[model samples]
Target: MLTFFALVHQEDDSAYGVQFPDVAGCFSAADDMEQVIRNASEALALHLEDGDLPAPRSLAEIKKDEDVAAELAHGAFLIAVPLISFTGRSKKANITMDAGLLQAIDDTASARDLTRSAYLASLARRDISG
Candidate 1:
């Protein structure tokens, strides 16, 4: 899971526009406020197709930049967009955990019709995004 900071702006009577600072030439737009995040996510996915994603900078670090600071001084704002890039391949790994926690994870996964790995991955995604 990866997260990117997007600069968002909207002019009077215009659609909202979003751009990723770290990803040059990648952008998206939506007429409604509610659709901004979804549109931006799709735009990022399409732009990054078969391309390596650059690591995201911390919010503090990003805000320190002159251009971003100028945008913030105006009406523009920052939004965190989670980017989950799946390579269409899976790899196995091993880990250690407490027995009680493992049992609880198994029970929850069974109730949700998900495997332990799936459940854990979902949890990680939610945690990072949230």
Candidate 2:
């Protein structure tokens, strides 16, 4: 997973605002702190879905910018947002696992009307993003 840094700002009576310094035109807002990471992750995924992804800079690099410095001085903060990319392609993989665990996974996937692969992918995405 690749991660990008987001600059977050909030006023006394408004929702929290977020912007990706490395990704132009990508932004998100959340009503509270709990939503910040999730909302930012979704916004970043959508923004890059149809475009080339930009290289993410480090915190030290972003902090060096004069504009970012000013923002930080004015109560803005930074957060790391993880990016999960999907290429719309699949490849075969062979793995060894305990038979009991495999059976449980298959049964749960069947109950949810999802394939084993899809269920595993969803779990990975949720864990990585949150």
CA lDDT of every candidate: 0.86, 0.91
- Candidate 2 per-residue lDDT over residues 7-79, each given as its tens digit: 9999998999999999999999999988898889989999999999899999899999888899999999999
Give candidate 1's error at residue 116 in angstroms.
19
| TM-score for each of the candidates | 0.66, 0.76
Clashing pairs counted in every model = 0, 0
Tell me the TM-score of model 1. Answer: 0.66
- After superposition, the stretches of candidate 1 with alpha carbons farther than 4 Å from their true spots are 86-130
Worst 10 residues of 1 by lDDT: 121-130
> By TM-score, who's the top model here?
2
Task: Return the lDDT, model 1, position 52.
Answer: 82
Query: Candidate 1 lDDT (Cα, whole model)?
Result: 0.86
